[model samples]
Target: MADDIHTTREPDGTTHTTTVVDRDPKRGGGAGITLLVVAALAIAAFLGFQFLGNEKAETGAVTEAAQKVGDAAQDVGDAAQEAVK
Candidate 1:
């Protein structure tokens, strides 16, 4: 920068100098924060997809249907035994 500077004292008692530096600490903060937020959102989305994405509902429905069929069969068998008695 034009204002940024470097200086040295010479053996002849002369001083050599350069411009002063201009610094802004907040310059990259916004971009860093944005990146952090994006990363967090990506992680959350991945976790959500991992946990919520599956065929469990279909499997559960099939299992429940099978259980109902088994119960119906047991009821029919019991009725037949009673008739025999």
Candidate 2:
């Protein structure tokens, strides 16, 4: 048995019909493109974050090494002054 079908009339006095099988193909394509763009942006953001994190780590290591070198030089200078006394 067929289900009850509904009908509607347009404002211009024309009969317009709609069915479940009638869908807009462009909508499907648009959704696919939107998903693809979002995925691409996500990947790009991840890579950018990784690059920035690595750069910060490298900078921190360099700064720590420089500070240690400066401390050693000060110690050596103190030792030299004590020897001359």
Candidate 3:
């Protein structure tokens, strides 16, 4: 009489008696795509805050701000011309 058993040899010169299981390839790719989309949305929100926050400085304040900017530029130009002399 013989015993009821089975065995198998793998490709790497190894013997085993087990079953192999396979997994889907899309699971990992889906996770990577989800992370990328979340990161993009976060960056867009940060930039939107920076740009929109400046628009609410004050009502009817554009002329005063522009004049101040022009005066500062003129001062800088005078200093540069003096340094060159």
Candidate 4:
């Protein structure tokens, strides 16, 4: 069953057949390779999500920081004007 069986017919009423058989099935390598590929893809997906989530959080923090900076600048300008009076 492990070996491939093939049969062919020739033009002049001739037949050809080929069969190869293995006493034992070759094992191992295939399943390991498949598992490694699946693991690699899973890790890639997880890291991609983590990076995107962190990027979104960092952008929000930057926006908040910018608003705080604007408020502080306004307070400084108000103090300087009061000193001139």
What Cα-based lDDT does every candidate model obtain?
0.86, 0.87, 0.80, 0.94
Any runs in candidate 1 off by more than 4 Å, and if so which?
1-17, 54-85
Where does candidate 3 clash, by residue pair? Answer: none
In the range 1-85, model 1's lDDT, one tens digit per residue, is 2365688899999999977767555576888899999999999999888766656777788999999999999999999999999
Candidate 4 stretches with Cα past 4 Å from truth are 1-24, 27-31
TM-scores, each model vs. reference: 0.45, 0.66, 0.40, 0.56
**lDDT tens per residue, model 4, 1-85:** 4887788999998999999785775787999999999999999999999999999999999999999999999999999999999
Candidate 4, residue 16: the lDDT equals: 92
By TM-score rank, best first, the candidates go: 2, 4, 1, 3
Model 3 lDDT-worst window of ten: 18-27
lDDT of 2 by residue, 1-85 (tens): 2344457898999886655454445655888899999999999999999999999999999999999999999999999999999
Worst 10 residues of 1 by lDDT: 19-28
Better of 2 and 4 by lDDT: 4
Off by over 4 Å in 3: 1-26, 58-60, 63-85
